[model samples]
Target: MNLLLLEDGDFTAADQVRLSGRRLAHMQEIQQVAVGDSLRVGRINGLMGHGEVTALTSSHAELSVQLSTPPPAKLPLTLLLAMPRPKMFRRILQHCATLGVPEIILLNSYRVEKSFWQTPFLQPAVVRENLLLGLEQARDTVLPKVRIEKRFKPFVEDQLPGLINNQLALVAHPGDYPACPRGIDQPLTLAIGPEGGWIPYEVDKLIEAGMQPVQLGERILRVETAVTALLARLY
Candidate 1:
């Protein structure tokens, strides 16, 4: 962890925090700092700063913190992702968070397996935990908001049009479509598909909802790789 991410429960005072659990174990193994060592820290959804380790124990540690700096700006991007395989889903969550995606929608696509929804990683607390891992990796304080859409058609017909009203909506697919646009200063809603990609009918629905289909290249890439590539190329 690049930063010690503090939640409200960690605070004993306005400027003091107690740490244990994963963070404490991390500090012991990875940081290996002694009393009086200063570590970078950020309050969740608050500020970035440094904390002085004032006390230490096998089970816990205490830090005197001062928060003044702001976290990095988030990308003006909302990712609509077809639920990936259980294992890769976890990595994608962290990847997006670290890359500064402010919002995400775990969407259903024709190729997406129904069983993918049963993954424990989608649980609210677990979801938050993975996102926090990303934030800590990026030294960011704000957690990205995540939404799930189990029904594809309803989401596209009833909601996506309105979402695209003020954004550049693009669906990433491999085809003869336009290349993914780059570095434009605009809000974006980017839809990415599952393992085999969106079915033809599904692509039509997104097009009708206002997304212009775009491509990376001929070589097929994994969902996580595609997401990272698309986001990096876009902005």
Candidate 2:
């Protein structure tokens, strides 16, 4: 883990934190930290800083921390994604956090399997666990907000218009649409569909809600790949 993330419960004092479990194991095995050694550290959804290993033992460790630096700025993007298969959903959540996506809406589409939503990975605690892994990898502290929407038409008709009202909204779909814009300076709301792509009626609904269709290329990308590619292309 690039950043040793501390939770509110980890704090023994204002400037002190106690560590155990995965973090302690990582320190003892991977980082192999010694007493008095300094390590990069950050609090969840808080500040980035350094911690000094003041005490250590087989079971736990204590660090004296000083936090001052703010976390990196999040991308000015709201991702609206058709829920992916269970097997790859965890990786996608991690990727979204690592890439600095500030908000995500897990949407439903015609092609999405109903069983995909039944995965344990969608549980609140499990989702937070994966997002934490991403934060540690990227040395970021702020967690991205994730929402799930099971009904498609209601969300598009009632809510999406307001969400995209003043934003540069686009839907990444394979067609004869314009290429995805690159390095844009405006905030965006991007919608991506399921594996076989959104059904024509769904695409029409999205267009009616204010999102213009755009294309990456002739290549059909997996949901995870499309997410990364579209975000990278946009900014």
Candidate 3:
């Protein structure tokens, strides 16, 4: 991971910050940092700066961090994704982070298997790891906030509107109304569905909630592929 991320409090203890477990190994295996080498760093919801590797042992590493400035502004996009299989889910989550999507909501759809909801990757830590990998790739420190919604109608009827306030909302579907708009220059909420795609009823519900159904093409894309394509196209 190129951009090392710490929580706001993780950097508050100015004197010394200890890194253990995966983070420590990341410095060794991924960054290959030596003592006296400085690393690019940022707080989870805050600043970016340099952290000097002052001490290192097999157990942990110590750093002197300076966080006087905030990290780059994240793109204002809320991704509404139908839950995919575990492997595809990991890639999609990481790509969302790397591509700078600020929020991701994994929602349920008819095509989505009920068992997919039971995956351990839904745990906060696993989700964070996938997002961290993306941030590391983009050299971004800010992590995208993730939410899970199991019921489609409740989430769409109750919560989706609040998310799209002051934002353009688009739902990617097959054989829909028109071409997906290109380079939309505003805060956006883009929705992509399962491998088999969103059922007609679900699309109708989203439309009632102020979302426009846009088509990618006649060709159908898998959930993982569609997400990257949609984000790239929208931005």
Listed per model in order, the count of residue pairs whose N, CA or C atoms clash below 3 Å is 0, 0, 0
Q: In model 1, which residue pairs have backbone atoms overlapping below 3 Å? A: none
lDDT rank order: 2, 1, 3
The TM-score obtained by model 2 is 0.99
List of clashing residue pairs for candidate 3: none
Tens-digit per-residue lDDT, 5-78, candidate 1: 99999999999999999999999898898999999999999999999999999989999999999999999888
- Tell how far residue 9 is off in model 3, in angstroms: 6.4
lDDT-best of 2 and 3: 2
Stretches of model 2 off by over 4 angstroms after superposition: none
TM-score, every prediction: 0.98, 0.99, 0.91
Candidate models: Cα lDDT each = 0.94, 0.95, 0.85
What TM-score, to 2 decimals, does candidate 1 have? 0.98
Stretches of candidate 1 off by over 4 Å are none
